[model samples]
Target: MEAWLDGLPADSVGLRNRGLAYGDGLFETIAVHNGRAVLLERHLQRLAVGCQRLALGHDATLILTEVTRYAAAMGEGVLKLMLVRGDSQRGYAADPGRPAMRILQASPPAAYPVVHAEHGIKMFPCATRLAEQPMLAGLKHLNRLEQVLARAEWQDSTFAEGLMLDTAGRLVEGVFSNLFLVRDGRLLTPDLSRSGVAGVMRSELLAQAERAGIPVWIGDLRLDDLAQADEVFVCNSVYGVWPVQAFAALNWPAGPVTRKLQAIARSLLDA
Candidate 1:
């Protein structure tokens, strides 16, 4: 079977595509609602940072224009924008002159269980831990073997997500979402200095919390901290916000802070 790249038809991707040969690229999954892409600028900003760090040449303005057009046409769906280093020769070194290719796609947003957002969801601690790489710390690069392995640690629907720690046993993030904790009336999230993707929704929530007078802190968190937290939540662009009803045997009520954040997220995301 063949598919289209953006709007043009393409039978098959080139065999030497750098994204396939090596995960040499970046991708952004954006949520669309009422024919609009949510947090589009933030997504582009992250992609730009990734390009800069990875030394991949990309036209940010062009990508933004393409995404805007696609989002408006799709009306409501998930937009995945993948920027690859184009084709490369059979070697580890990349050609500096190769033009980047943008694979734009749109699909229906996932229909998550209502209980997950309302009553909250359960999480299990995964055995797989993320390795520290300061150079790749907060970029959502195409290389996601760590997340892939962590996600494969479980297969049941009982746990909506799995919590992954760093090599030093400090809490980092979920398999696919950014983790946050509310403790002693303060909002806390793991610092992504050494690992983890700095999610767009996470940044939005932090800004919203600040404007709303919520005490927010970003630092290294421990399992004991989660146990002592007054409330816990996880967020991503697609799912918005999901309260953590329980982790292992320790359970927490969805406190005011989490509910407030959820309300804010709904206003911005649910449309």
Candidate 2:
């Protein structure tokens, strides 16, 4: 089966499902290599947190078992695990008694240009500002209208990503990934307490940096701060890491810290 809906062969959900109607759900994009899901634990951790925060009931063990079974069948690709509030009649209030819906899908991971990984890619500073919602901050919820709108701001092959800032004008993240910067031998990432998804790769990089004796900080960053950085990078679970060569007029080389973190990310995720 290419997809499973609550452990059954299915490719579509109902029209009234809360996930589709109101984006009452969460999802994780996992990389599968050699019949095993990479960073499965981290993905599940985030999912659990989302479920708790949303007051949605989910079986973590069941979801993990199904994900493993599904990924093994479609080895060496991307696996998306989606948890929805389940099918409900026309209403915003979810029924706590109803069981949650789980979706597992497998797709071929995109074959990115090797040069993009070797060197780096240019990005456009998106004009779409993210609205700060503390309740939804850091959770990879199904609601991605902001990112969709930001991504639509540009359609040029020259720009590989779009950098977005929160409504308060603090740097947030890339449209589809987490942002990081290096300056004076310290690693700094935008604080996502108000917006943006706290990506699994971001978490891994923070831990790895600590282990590698690199000082790391999570704080509010502005465009000027990013421009002053020696090196910058964007990361996702599937793409691993992409060094930011330039954003607007500012330019930066793929410095030592970025390269080191990139290597570490590959090793950790590919293991």
Candidate 3:
């Protein structure tokens, strides 16, 4: 894997970079297929929203241009873009006028077990819970210690992902993906207003569902909801969608809705 810092080949960032120092930044993991960035606009839109919410100064046009060029060069792979507040003095205070730093890394596409998407996966009941921070809820901020800890909870092939809940015990999302439930032909996903990431794939799925005449609901979700769901699945921009068959004592089959949405996700990622 190689990285580009500010559109130049680089292996390291400045010692005082705010992103390295305080995890002060946002990132996007994009998929590139046949020299094209998948969901490029949606990814950039989310990054723009994060920049606005964080008061980070960034040039959206420059980012788009560079990301496009990089993705073209990457062909079929994963492109990770990190935008940070640049270097600063050794303190919590940051210069508002400082230019942001852009770090881009390209790696080969992720490989997961075929059984995960075929027979479905068993989810680990993670004890790590997400903290409710409305200000930073939906943004893909650089601070990801919570997810780091949650992911570390499992280290076996038996579980494909971990189920994460918010501090208030509300069903939030997967360790690195968004959660969704299909109930009575309705699509239900957790609201990220107070916790979890508003994943690009999740947003896309909701829009696709609505356009396809599937009733979509976004709000608080509970374990009882998952238990009663007719189908369960988790999704990310990279891996698309994986049907979750088991979480703790509860189990579900990959039903018609899961298959339908999985196909939709497959088409999007493959496109």
The Cα local distance difference test for each model comes to: 0.90, 0.92, 0.93
lDDT of 2 at 35: 88
Ranking by lDDT: 3, 2, 1
lDDT per residue for candidate 2 within 1-271, as digits (tens), equals: 4689999999799988999999999999999988899998999999999998999899888998999998889878899899999888887988997768999988897788887889999989899999999899999999999999999999899999999999889999999999999999999999998999999999989999999999999999998998789999999999899999999999999999999999988886678
Give the alpha carbon lDDT tens digit for every residue of 1-271 in model 1: 1224644646568899999989999999999998899999899999999988888888787788878878888888788888889887899899776657888877887889999999999998899989999999999999999989989988999999999999999999999999999999999999999999999999999999999999999999999998789999999988889999999999989889999999998888878
Q: For model 2, what is the error of residue 111's alpha carbon versus the real structure, in angstroms, after optimal superposition?
A: 1.4
TM-score of 1: 0.96
Task: Looking at model 2, report the run of 10 residues with the lowest lDDT sum.
Answer: 91-100
Looking at model 2, residue 216 earns an lDDT score of 99
lDDT tens digits by residue: candidate 3, 145-257: 99999999889889989999998999999998999999999999999999899999999999999999999999999998987899999999998889999988999999988
Backbone clashes under 3 angstroms, per model:
0, 0, 0
The candidate that achieves the highest lDDT relative to the unseen native structure: 3
